[model samples]
Target: MPDNVLENVGEEYEFEFVDVQSTPVVINSLGSDSADVGLLAYSSLANAIQNEMIPGGQSVIAPLTYDGPRYADTYNSTSGSSITDINGLDGNTLGVNGVGSAIDIAARVVLTRNDIDLDNVEFREVSFGAMPSTLSEGRVDVGTFIQPFFEMNSDDLQTVFDTTDAFGSFLKIFVTARDDFIDENDDAIRAFLGDLWTGIEWWKDDDNSETRLDIAEEVVELPRDLLEALVQTDRGYYHGEDGLAIDPEWLQKPIDGMAEVGFLDEEIDMSEYVDNSYLPEEANTEPTIE
Candidate 1:
């Protein structure tokens, strides 16, 4: 997940989802350029906040520490490795969606953890839609993209490194909406959470394995094999319970690190940036379906 996604709806709730993409016109039809709530890759939303696209978005729960393949996502979600760690990334180029973009920052942040200087790592800004393709062509050393890009094309590409490597679970896929949305349509937001949780619940049920795979392939549009791998028992996606559960330690570490690296302003308080009351009392708290 890219950074912009914010949570904190409630400690009671857990996890995050990638906001389904629709045509720009469809997004515009929401009646306001300001989406009361929008699910985004954690980094995307994080970048949005940095640019003031939305105010006060915080990650509620980080279900899975996010990871991007080192190369194009043609195949191999868990196959090849990227840079094999930051030390390998000491002096190299990173391809990103754009200049000074979230992907660039995420890559830099991961590298910075190894005491790598941003000035030393060259950045190549390409269009978001074209990044994966660009990486596959060997035009760039590394690229940061969410699921479909890496999932669909990891056939030959590799994941050099992720936020989790240097920062310890710093990666996260998240759900976020503008602060106004949280203040205004509490019910709508709640409903959104319910449906989202239901969707994930259905996705993890063993008896419903067929259905789950179907949705992942058709609904979520995930690569068939990768979707299956994610649904396997005791691995991928679901944790003790809430697939969306935010690891407090994981969440805060990145926040603290980002600020330490000058990615965020110290003036911003985490509380004002997020809220967690919206989560229901019993999230998928147990790994067992019981």
Candidate 2:
């Protein structure tokens, strides 16, 4: 999305994409002023603030994606495995990219709801790329998958459950910056958000579907047909009528869930951390596309 935004409004502002491995690193970068803006899972915000990872802490400025019934992270086992559902996960190993990551927290919430003791369920930190193989090899009874990984390997996996089953439709990933940086670059941030909303609007239009898939094909390393399937399903991204507006209620679900599962020290009020003021007025208006 940032790349698309740059293409449409490059003359107005400059952006450099830095590849970071995880949300913690993104938070560290923002806290140190090394990065003006970073993408992070909504579940990590409270912990970052509580740990004092950022000097003045971070503020979420825009939502990047949402996860729910149609699209969400999933816990899966090999297609013919004995672990047919969440009930089969008891006293078994679960794989996640990180122990306290958004994926892990979501899984914890689901397990807790099923009356499964977290102490009995082992959480193995398996990278996303390794999850499919890990499950197939019996190294982990279930592994969490996101995006193209899930779509790419669906034929061999059976989903035990989806995160949405626990938290409902919730804000997944979001854009954040240090509170001080937001204060310093108010107008520039607003302009950037406006352009970002423009990019989002362009992408959400059904007319641009082919072009969007063509662009994804270049970067995603997936078959053309698979890419088309993702595009057909809105690529599992949230494109609401409010454009780039961040709904505090959408974010609060995960925040409260994270705390319930002990991923966060306590629930952080999302309204306090979300600053929709940076979004332009047009963002609140309904999208022009159907």
Weakest 10 consecutive residues, lDDT, candidate 2?
281-290
The C-alpha TM-scores of every prediction are: 0.66, 0.92
User: Top model by TM-score, which number?
Assistant: 2
CA error at residue 179 for candidate 2, angstroms? 1.7
Model 2 residue pairs with clashes: none
Off by over 4 Å in 2: 1-8, 232-235, 285-290
User: How far off is residue 14 in model 1, in Å?
Assistant: 22
lDDT of 2 by residue, 1-290 (tens): 55543443465566788788988888878878889899988756767876888897778888776786357889999999899889898989999999888888888898899999999999999999988888888999999999888988999999999888788888788889888887887777887887777877777678988888888888876798988878648556555535666768778888898889876766678888888788878885422221
Q: List the global CA lDDT of all models.
A: 0.50, 0.81
Candidate 1 overall lDDT versus native: 0.50
Candidate 1 to truth, TM: 0.66
Q: In candidate 1, what are the lDDT values of residues 115-163, reduced to their tens digit?
A: 8888887777776568766766767666666545554555656556554
